[model samples]
Target: MAKSPMDTLQLSYIQIAIAFLLFAQAKSTTEHTSTPQPNDTNTACIASERSALLAFRAGLSDPANLLSSWKGDDCCGWKGVYCSNRTGHVVKLDLQGSGYTIDSDSRKVLAGNISSSLLGLQHLRYLDLSFNEFDKMQIPEFIGSLHKLRYLDLSMSMFIGRIPPQLGNLSNLQYLDLRSSYQDRDIHDGTYSTDIMWLSRLTSLEHLDMTYVDLSAIVHWLPVVNMLPTLKFLFLTSCQLRTSPESLQLSNLTSLETLFLVGNQFHQRSTPNWFWDLTSLKYLDISYNGFYGPFPDEIGNMTSMVELHLSANSLVGMMPSNMKNLCNLEVLYSYTSNINGSITELLHR
Candidate 1:
């Protein structure tokens, strides 16, 4: 049958409408399948990791109810626990306390055993239990088994006895802080490390702080510390370090920015120190030591120094003329009696 022009136009319109409907239907089907649906894998954490965390919490005495939220199967939802979004694996456990303060009540901090059950967390990378009470127990040797650990902080905790050498097994560790508080300094009951040879294994270390930890017995401590090429911030205040023999004349701390060696036993010595080679130093504090005699002219070499502390020492003699080269210097702290000559010449530089 021969159709008229009007009939043809109407047929074409019908065909276009049918094609549009078909396209819409196919698009809706793809959107339904391709869209992300609720999966139990993403919402629920790994079963084995959850059990490990529960066991870890069992050994702790949470006086402040810090672990009160540590209930239910989803351990990821618990306090101070973080899980990987993709794998649902536990990666970090941070239970840092407010530290033992004179004004705060004893019930405010966590006190008890750090369970060995933490070994079950194979993927764990970061662990921090600083500022808590551990009943003066030694650090567990089993902690060395966690090979994935990158950050470990036990500072200001009431741990006693020698620092476990097993901590050296953490080759990936970047930050290690074990600053402790002593119950009795006379008896040396606080954490002490006589043999720190294991420290050389931590090649990736960047920041190390061992304030208040007795390292006087370790005569070769300086050389072992120099092994860390990436170390930037080092704090060894009140560690009873000695300043004799001058084992290392030049430090390998190319990236070292801040150094604190206050309250050490560098007694009655005018010898040249090794740290003067660190021209990159921004902050240096060597106060409260037994250093005596003339201040070394080497101080002028550290032009990058911003703050220099030489207080509480027996240093004497005039300021070095080269000290005027410290253009970037901002703060200079020293005992006035330590300076003998006129400061007008150095100040004008």
Candidate 2:
């Protein structure tokens, strides 16, 4: 009375199904057990960031209520302190315009200075210290150590020192604003160098603002910016650029949309032929310079232009007849220039 082959096969199938179910259950249990519970990385990183902030606060004579709630017990909830939810790493620390007072009697405001402790923010990405007073402090070279930094704003901070070439090490940097910090008197020491060739290493930079920084000696440095193919918004107002290069070409910066060169000294020269080739340019300002020459007939090539400012220059020529081709142009400023052209046609369009 041997069991049929079909019955034996059925028994084996049931055994195999049970074994498979048990193995799946065991795997699920292991995964549940091995999953890492929330730990100290987040806590430690937050603490470190807070500690850096506290050090900065202590260094200041007065913090002007900007750091009122920056206590250690509940640092994660501190204002202007942003931490990663999962990893707890501090990523953003914005302390702009803190308005700290120096002395009780004199009540002189102590503008924020660059604290070396801020370099400890290993994961910091966005830092805005603009509109504060750095009191003639030099930008700390340690800032170059922030490998993960992407956006930095030190504009209007009153910092007086040579631009740190080490900033080129920030390969991930995308936005940089250092405008209006240095005054005309700051140039007496001749510390400013036109050797900004290190800026080419910041290939990721898209928006750059270096207005009013006394760049008269660095006319050659202007062309070097073309190396950054990713540059989109460029502001170089009042930089004392004395001339436009004959071979000035920026066709590679196809993504450029906004360009500001107001109050630069162009030495009364012909507009560079390459200027018409920027097909992506939307906003352009070249006002208050010495650009003297005929407007290029190919000016219409920049059909994407929406706003164009060329006022207060010594340009002498008939306006290009092709100017009517700029259908997208909304605002055009040619005042104070020797531009001769009938405006009736442009007004009609």
Candidate 3:
């Protein structure tokens, strides 16, 4: 049909309107397709958390240049830092000091207050600040707030004062080591913990080492440790823990496998009756104490015992006759003690 001018104009306007709509729709579709995925956007370290880590580094004196990798914006890739794959949240920070003897130059050690900014890293699960020198500062109480922490090691660090009971707040903690080396004990002024009631809350704790920390005042140590059903390795060397364990307390430590009680104040050659009560012990060390009397017959019950050390004490009499049952025994140290009878048969066995 031959159209009028008005009809032609109307038809042209309709076509133009459709073309414009199509162009707009194509542009929108292109833009939508190019949009970044949520996971890609989350690949970068969270800005606030990165800042928090940088702030934490700022307070440290890094003479060794150990934290040089901490310059960039992406903290997940920083040295000694670990981030979650799903959320990119900082999960672990290990700033262990360079392996240096105490007598050597100590400049590599980190010293200063731990910045509160670390609290922003709410997902931190493992923190190890061992072998550093914090100038005898008390362990910060705020660290207890890191609820997700599973492993924490401050061993050989120069922290002094009562171990903050606040650490009990880490309910998920599985391994904790605050042990000081022989050098640390000599150079540092003092460190001790009088109360450990908070330990009762860490139901998941497995390995615990508090060697060289004075624990003489904690009368409930046995009872408190007994509550941890999952405990396996325990190191309490030179703790001066004088209290004896009660039968009730000994009954609960059924899972303990390795025990180190080296250099304590349990003054006698006679083995404490409770020593035999640890039926699951595979390793035992009670060296440099005042133990006396004959070798314990009750010790034969521990068929799983692998190492036995009873040196530098007053242990007397012949070795127990029933010790042949400890077929798993690998190492035995009975040097520097008083009179001891020979047992060639036990040795051959």
Give me the candidate number with maximum TM-score: 1
User: Model 2: per-residue lDDT, tens digit, 180-265?
Assistant: 65547357422254678878999988778787776766757756788888887787777777766565543568888777777777
> How many residue pairs clash per model?
0, 1, 6
- What lDDT score belongs to each candidate, Candidate 1 first? 0.77, 0.68, 0.74
Best by lDDT: 1
lDDT of 3 by residue, 1-349 (tens): 3456786566446433543343334334432432222233346798999999999988987877888899877777787777777878877787888544755665466778799898998888878888888876888899999899887888777788778899999998887888754334433455778898898899998778887887877777887887898887777878887765525633767887777777788774465556688889987777666777777777889999987777666777767778889889877767655545666767798
Model 1 regions lying over 4 Å from their true place: 1-43, 244-250, 341-349
lDDT string, candidate 1, 117-209, tens digits:
899998887788888888678889999899998778888788888899999999988878888777256434789988999999999987788
Give the CA lDDT, 0 to 100, for residue 176 in model 2: 77
TM-score of each: 0.83, 0.80, 0.83
What is the full ranking by lDDT, best candidate first? 1, 3, 2
Q: Model 1 residue 328 lDDT? A: 81
